[model samples]
Target: MKTLDFKPKLVSAIRNYNKQTFMADLMAGLIVGIVALPLAIAFGIASGVSPEKGIITAIVAGFAISALGGSKVQIGGPTGAFIVIVAGIINQYGIQGLTIATLMAGVFLIGFGLLRLGTIIKYIPYPIIVGFTSGIAVTIFTTQVKDLLGMQMDAVPSDFIEKWIAYFQNLTHIDPWSAGVGLVSVAIIASAPKFSKRIPGSLIAIIVMTVVVLLLKQYAGVTSIETIGDRFNISSQLPDAVVPELSWETIKGLVAPALTIAILGAIESLLSATVADGVIGDHHNSNTELIGQGVANIVSPIFGGIPATGAIARTMTNINNGGRTPIAGIVHAVVLLLIFLFLMPLAQYIPMACLAGVLVVVSYGMSGWRSFTALMHNPKSDITVLLLTFFLTIIFDLTVAIEVGIVCACLLFMKRMSETTDVKAVYDEIDLNEDADMERGNLEHLSIPKGVEVYEINGPYFFGAGNKFEDLMGGFGDRPKVRIIRMRKVPFIDSTGLHNLENMCLMSQKEGITVVLSGVNEKVEAVLRRNNFHKLLGQENICNHIDLALARANEIVG
Candidate 1:
């Protein structure tokens, strides 16, 4: 069994802590915290929770992820990706359901880490990931249209098509003042990057738009514009812990969504860690990263927050701003906590349309349109999976898209594996120099007996290829007296492959045909010994070369 990787990067980073590193971390943390503020608020509101809850998540979950994560500069908080699922859960099962689901997801993440399945997760089909992420961006963009345009509607339907139709119906009811504020907010955020890299665009958009909205509402008598204060009762202090009532029924109902959260969290956190690793020239412990994320998710929701994961954008910001340790992340959490305790009430002045505008940019970033378009030029099968996952996420739900996408990817993988492994019969040739075994090189050619046949397997003998090989074996009619099976190129044999080989041995025995194994690799031979195939086929008949196998076959033939 593998040892648990529970060590956090903070522990390792602190061993070499210095004043210079501390100052650098402080600066980066301060900047990242400022960057996280508007995003947290926007992600919070978009996720169907209050703005304060988003801040609370940034403080609490952000701290946990940084303090306990394996990566040096990973920043954890509420992100735009969770908006769809969190909102959907709230819409269906209520707040308690979201809470329980987050808790369950945390448990699942911990289990995944403890099981040491991190490397496996990193290999999940890339196309499926792109598809899901792109679809999420589209869904997020769709959700923001109402807020972005200031549509006068009671409630936006959750279904994708229904929501768009309602938007069309409400097009004539657009609040011009709100629309003006939203459009201006979007323009500012979209263009602010050219002004200064030191400041975040979303923050500038909020400050500028908040002042404009306030001035218009106060002096110009424009009462149509909406702000955070008008929507949610913004809180200044950390809220009391919320204990959700859990029942078996609730657990059963939330399992699917909870699993989705676990998968998303694992994929995102590890991807962020991997990206940070490339830039930092350091490797992150994936298991430790996952456990840290699990801890964050489990704790944040108790404080009335939603699911939390490592934010890639903020992480890159930390790197770009000279953050080289977990200290920066911890400091960022402290910064957010201070804001939560003191400056949270000011968030009420932040316009909801500005947040919608912030998210509008966010959605566009996550769209991965360049990658999506590039993938369109890939293999037809990849394109099929991409489009399927994309449409399913928009039309139905993320849960459905992920599950179906994974299944299809697996099936396609197996199909490709089976196509690559081939079993060929070489009955006429006997070239000793052409032998695969290097140990038996530079020898004379050996002739095959009249009643002997030699077959070579070219790839992995997994279940997919095993069944086809078994069928080919069954197709044989003029059975030879001596049959040589070459597996020098065979890397490993799964259970099905072993079973098929065992059955072939039994059938050959009953048909009075002597079977000789030649060039079986050490690993496959070890597997055969463990399964007692050596005992059934007789050990002498298994040879390291055709020279010995043919000699044994000649004895059997005599």
Candidate 2:
């Protein structure tokens, strides 16, 4: 196998990082940081952790991924994808467990990159990807209802259906003020781009909602809803690294969650990188990006951060705002760092409902509702794979969803491929065109010889399509006096396909009948020689085309 190689272009634009680009990146970074800030906090809280973890992830993991990653504009941080996994880890094993799992996941990512499995990851079926992605979106959206509506629930269960039931049971207790803030926040953030492109709607919404809540508190003295400070005390101190306890029992328990984190992180990060490539017209080194993300996840957990990956929305904002290099990603991280140190206290006043609203939008985007519905319009095989993966993701766990989805896709693909495999009687009508030759050809007027059969396979000879060859050969009521199997149309044959050919040859030999092959492409012929099928069936029987094989068949019969 030829090894996969990529040549990195190490061109420098630092000398030309003129004031214009710098200012653009600076502002873009700031805007993305603000957008990320509330998101980081909300994601962390949703994942069953404190607010600081999310910010720390944005600062530490975000910086590491951008500084070392392959893409020029990818923004890395805790995304909506990890909410369910993180929550499960935290619920089952605690924060220490989550940290250990994150670290282990990092190791897995690095190993995957080192093993050069980057290209193989792309083979993951589209239906499976959409299925779990849509499922994750729904899960995130459901998780935020309690916070968005200001419902008083001590703990939200992890099960999907149970959580919804819990939400509806508490529907009557919704706080009207918090609901109003969430709805307004959503509107302002959603409609911000219509008014101005430079400033993000989320930041504007946060400011507007925050100031409104502040004025209400100061003037109207309304105290119905909770804020970040009331839920978890805010601190301005820089987050410190905490060493995780790596006990045998903890490692054993964290293995599954760690694998889940690693797989989902790889999927989301690569997907985001691919999306960035399209937006910027640049290709990303997937293996290098995976390694970078691994390092980020590994290091961020030590600093009290959660699992992180390349964030698509943030990366898009960076690109739209003229952030054209990795420097922008680094700047974005630094911008968040400054906010964490200086503006942490101010963030306390940003209502929890505002954060919930931001995440609501995040969930909607991540859910990819448009694409999910679009997938329904695809082929039935694709629809089956999509719905299977989606429902499995919602009902069970993501790992299971992915496992089953891939398997289902593989089975469905084999089924389709098998359907494409056809055994045809090509005498007088190979192309099936309505032109001359078929009715007037010499062979067309010739009478069929008793106990002689001819069949042509017209596609790639892979296992799925290969097995059907036996059925075609067996379709003859009795063993033919001679059989000519034409394989000129088969571009290539895999091991299983060759094995089937050998079986057909052996069966013909046992019946004291001759089997001849015609139009064998060089690749398939090479496989036959390598498998010693040529010797078993005699090289004289194998010809370059159907005409030569028919001549040889005639000689054998005479």
Give the winner by TM-score: 1
lDDT of the candidates, in the order given? 0.89, 0.81
Clash list (residue pairs), candidate 2: 451-481
What are the models' TM-scores?
A: 0.96, 0.90
Q: Which stretches of candidate 1 lie over 4 Å from their true place?
A: 438-444, 470-477
| Residue 357 displacement in candidate 1 (angstroms) | 0.7
Candidate 2 C-alpha lDDT tens digits along 1-558:
746332222124365667887787777787788778778888888888888889989989999888777677889999998998888778778888889999999999888777766667877887888889889888888888887888877687778899999988888889888899988899988898899887777788888999999888889888976788888888878766778778888888778788888888888888888998998899888887888888999999998899999998889988888888777888888988888888889878888888889888888887877888899999998999999888887877787888788888988888787677676763432442321312334343343465678887878787766566666665667666788887867888887777777777787799898989878878888988988877898999888875567678778778
Q: Give me candidate 2's TM-score against the actual structure.
A: 0.90
Question: What is the overall TM-score of model 1 with all chains considered together?
Answer: 0.96
Clashes in candidate 2: how many?
1
Q: List where candidate 2 sits over 4 angstroms from the true fold.
A: 1-20, 247-255, 426-450, 474-478
